[model samples]
Target: MPPSAREAANEQRRRLHHEADVVVVGAGIFGCAIAFALARQGRSVLLLERWLKEPDRIVGELLQPGGVAALKKLGLGDCLEGIDAIPVTGYSVIYYGQAVGIPYPLNAGADLGSTGGDTKGNGEKPSRPEGRCFHHGRFINQLRQACAREPNITIVETEVTKTITGTHNPQVLGVESTTRNPKTGLREKGYYFAHLTIICDGYASNFRKQYINRKSVVKSRFYALELIDCPMPTPNYGIVILGESAPVLLYQIGTHETRALIDVPENTPTASPAAGGVRAHLRNVVLPSLPKQVQPCVEAALADGKIPRSMPNSWLPPSTQTEPGVVVLGDAMNMRHPLTGGGMTVAFSDVVILSSLLSPERIPQLGDTAAVRRAMKEFHWRRKGLSSIINILAQALYSLFAANDSQLKALQRGCFAYFQKGGNCLDGPVGLLGGIIHQPMVLVYHFFAVALLAIWLVIKEV
Candidate 1:
């Protein structure tokens, strides 16, 4: 399937019955964007998905400011529009019934996000850049629509069974899929071929174990409850509620719906069925801690008697990509805890970096396995700047927020205290959390500052 400029021009992209220049195995956040990007570069792309239906999930509802910047890079910024998406200015964290506001940095890394502020410099200084939150399915539908409009891209609704590989060598040829025949309404076996195959099947990918050596670590789950027309202490700001137990997250995904995710660590007796299960815990523990205005909404949401749905909070470090003709990416390759809402931010950033490295100018032929492998190596190291910041912060913060030991509890209190100090003490950490800051040393500096402060407070109390 490798082609020269002349061969590529002569090939009919519409005749994509079996082969193409590239095969993308998921139409998710990463899949659609990558397909559209490669197709625009004159590569025939086959975008495969098990189902074309809009996704329904609480994860990826919040996109950090840095993610918005990367979305614009992919030219899919408009996908955020027409969905009644809320502008996220910052976060509201509540510890032991006391609340603090953590706003995005004024500079916000030269204003990376496209929403919330007029930075046109019309004499007004400009507001801080903003992040966004919305219905995950709505945003995904927009991305799929964008892919459908790309001429060189062919969107197929099929379940990718496995990768098709050459017998002589381990080089991936394409994918074997199960597609429903439109005429018979029965799924039939099919195979699609390409020089390059990208597997971004998301957090629950079936292909991940076959390709990567690392495994995801799961310690807790975020149980979800959608609060309708909920009132918040701070408008358009995400809320984090901390107590002696695990932390809870609340954010407005749309004008009418507020998503509430209450973290429950593994083996916590509060969530044990013998202890009256999760409902009893939410009603007795979480409800009382919420703001007076938001309390009623939780009551109403809980009144319906539907058990809360849960998603695992997992973490997996990055692994190098070395397999020829196949690249495993996105959540499959790496994942972090969802506590910071940084998943989409890292996904878009990876797309921005990987797409550029594999761009036509950089690697003229994707079929050139050696050239593509080199680019993947570059991508692994290049993505570390932001991904490392996010991965470390996510796993570490969760440990602090869900502190079960005295030491971690001390660190949690220090974090809340650090936020109150204002200036860099606040902006530096919040900027990093919002994905606007990338300086690892800045994070290290601030973390130790809090640790020192924690020690001082402990000594004073003693």
Candidate 2:
């Protein structure tokens, strides 16, 4: 064969090796979810991941009621249900060593699953589902399995380096990646062209950073540790133990295991391995702060005096989409503290909105710069406010509990006492977190007003 003919053949082979209508980066929950959602819509999708399965990190183990609803919308309840994820009835905010449980959806954990048990046919859309808690690794594997079964989906275990955009315009055309390099034991560099690119590479997405020059704010306060065994029997309840310093959280997972996070501020000696030590700090500083019964679990878990795991509570700022035809979702866009565990749900919510808005009818017209910007504008506007609110609330709660602020501590106690008097104001934030209250800003304002009045009445009585 002629050298020219051989060269042409090699080029043709390279072109055939890479193809897709959409390319999704990061094969974690969000990436697999995007691939599944797009494939269901009859769009060809290629998903790239550095790992085949999602990491079993101390992240997103709990899904809020809203998150449960998002999974149902994507037909994931049955799969998740099979994994033995427990239903989270509500949340309890332990302030000043006092536990006040706020039941989800007016104290009734409603049935909103797709099995028609919790669903109501409004003739337009289905009702929301109850919150669920599962092992992160198990849940993500199920999602990957679902995506892999689809013919229109291709899951590739690889690393994506750069997002390629048009030279003339700033719209993303596809991505460049390394499949498996012979020298590096990874693959050679390759490219995949697509009409749209969804970046779900998490809070540390290279693609997201390349398009927009933003950095993540790293707060090295408390780290997390998971325990498979404890001294006492397991309970259904999860506790948020507030302290004058960094707060701690303890919860039961499954039958015999429990998870705990000892949140020590960066300035505190609690986080220092040499200052107080992890186990000693938990025993002397944190344990004495909790009830006697809870003390046993902490002691038993730290019996080894060496935690098997730890993770810093890091948060990322809101990401802006600079590359057109490319949009980021999930933690890649915005990340809050895991104390709330709403990250996955928030990402899934973005997927639903983006998928609906970017249907064939919309994508074709997105060719224009203004229209492309407008689509992203809507996406940003839709998510920014909510994320900001959640992040602020989570951070505020963390700071309030972790600090030695007499005023904040008093405020926390008074707020719970107010709720005990059948105050409806606290119900709104609960509803908002559960997906029952869609407009969180309005509801929160109302809550604030009611809280102000209640505080005033208490002051007058004094």
Candidate 3:
């Protein structure tokens, strides 16, 4: 707390200064994508990672086609081809014992045609490749390796301590971090200076608190248990098993690996059961509600999995930016339920948009402060619109399975019945939110008309 102590600390930080064209915090898929994009543009980039090992828990294993297209743009899709992620063609909605699957419509190579100054393909070739679910840890590790192979990029395994700001205004100039040397276990504090500082530092970010102090209110109603080596059916697809008690989602990833998300409602008492102990409870409560064929796989998955901690349905502050010189992307800026599988897609899109705005040619035209601010503004405008839409849809979906009252059940049944006939009141918002369509309200209007028609038909039948 003394002046000398503070000066020494500042001096030490300055001594470790690292200069780059850009400093990206967090080494998840989001950060890697941005770093890869920028490095391709000949920018000297530094990527900082808080942990060397990828966190094993319930996170996005699903990568939507839009995100795949983004990956293809970076020329990293070839790297992913080696990982063997299962391509998903569509999604399924479950309610009241019935399931309805919705396939994604093809994009028709519109963007690719535009690249050559010709609008060909005639809606035949998909603009975006089909989505796939992969093991998050494996996927991230692959991306990290790909970035390491690039000459313009460097990886720093350090925990960010603070963001350096310019005096007159709160403009981020650089980042201060600390990493322990593996040989000596001695902590070495360092500074990374950059023209731009991007925060992709996950949900709990110190820099994020410096700007937007928004906290997540929606707690986890579930925990995930990942398992391997079981006679479980290869869920070549994703499925949500809805039940009266806790709904569990089971799916496959990366060949032999299987990921299971078992809902543990907040209302349920925690007795701290063993890994597979919850399986008995699940059988007694959720399994009977599912199809008979699914029961064996569910039991096998439970038996072979490890019980991870609770999964929070997290969110970010309405505004994720507080400073002028820095921008927050991915979960750092905002997040929705992973079930919708839109996290990395939004983050990757931010990379594309931000890269365009931050190009050396454009930087002179826009100025540093103005350009970064514009990027953040545009990032929010695009992502927040998508986030709000996802939140509404996810909440509605969860409420149906979470409901216990008779009135809620009746409403859910009726809604499910209507949706079965190809009705989606949230379709417009969903389309926009899912990045399938840009204008969200159009899907909303279509959904409303469908709902009205369905209601009228039911009334006529009655």
Top candidate, metric lDDT? 1
Clashes of 3: 3
For candidate 1, give the lDDT of residue 260.
Answer: 93
lDDT of 1 by residue, 1-462 (tens): 554654344245435356788999999998988887787777788899999999999789999898998899888999999999999989988999898999888876465855445456689877887899999999999999998887777788999999988999999999998989899999998898899999999999899899999899999999899999988788888899998668889999989999999998888887789998888888887788777898899899899887888899888888997899999988988999999999999999898898899998988888999999999999988988889899889988898888988888888888899888888888898888888888788889988999999888788878
What are the lDDT figures for the candidates, one per model? 0.87, 0.66, 0.65
Against the true structure, candidate 1 reaches a TM-score of 0.96
lDDT pick, better of 1 and 2 = 1
| Candidate 1: C-alpha RMSD after superposition | 2.5
**Candidate 1 deviant stretches above 4 angstroms:** 1-15, 109-121
Candidate 3 per-residue C-alpha lDDT over 122-232 given as tens digits, one digit per residue, 9 for 90 to 100? 764433326777877778888899988876777878999988887886677888889899899999987888878888888766666666667666644466665564344
Q: 2 or 3: which has the higher TM-score? A: 2
Give the best candidate by TM-score.
Answer: 1
- Per-residue CA lDDT of model 2 for 1-462, tens digit only, reads 775564345334324765667788888878887788877776667888878845677666777776676777886666576776766666666655666776665332353344223334555443223577677888888888898787667777778888887889778888888887657884688788777788888766675566656666656445556566553222444456665546676665545556677776555675477866665666678778766676776666677767547666767767667567787777776776766666776777777677666666676543455566677778777865455556666665565555466666555655566655554655665666555455657656854764585577568767
**Backbone clashes counted, model 2:** 7
TM-scores of the candidates are: 0.96, 0.84, 0.82
**Model 1 scores what on Cα lDDT?**
0.87
Ranking by TM-score: 1, 2, 3
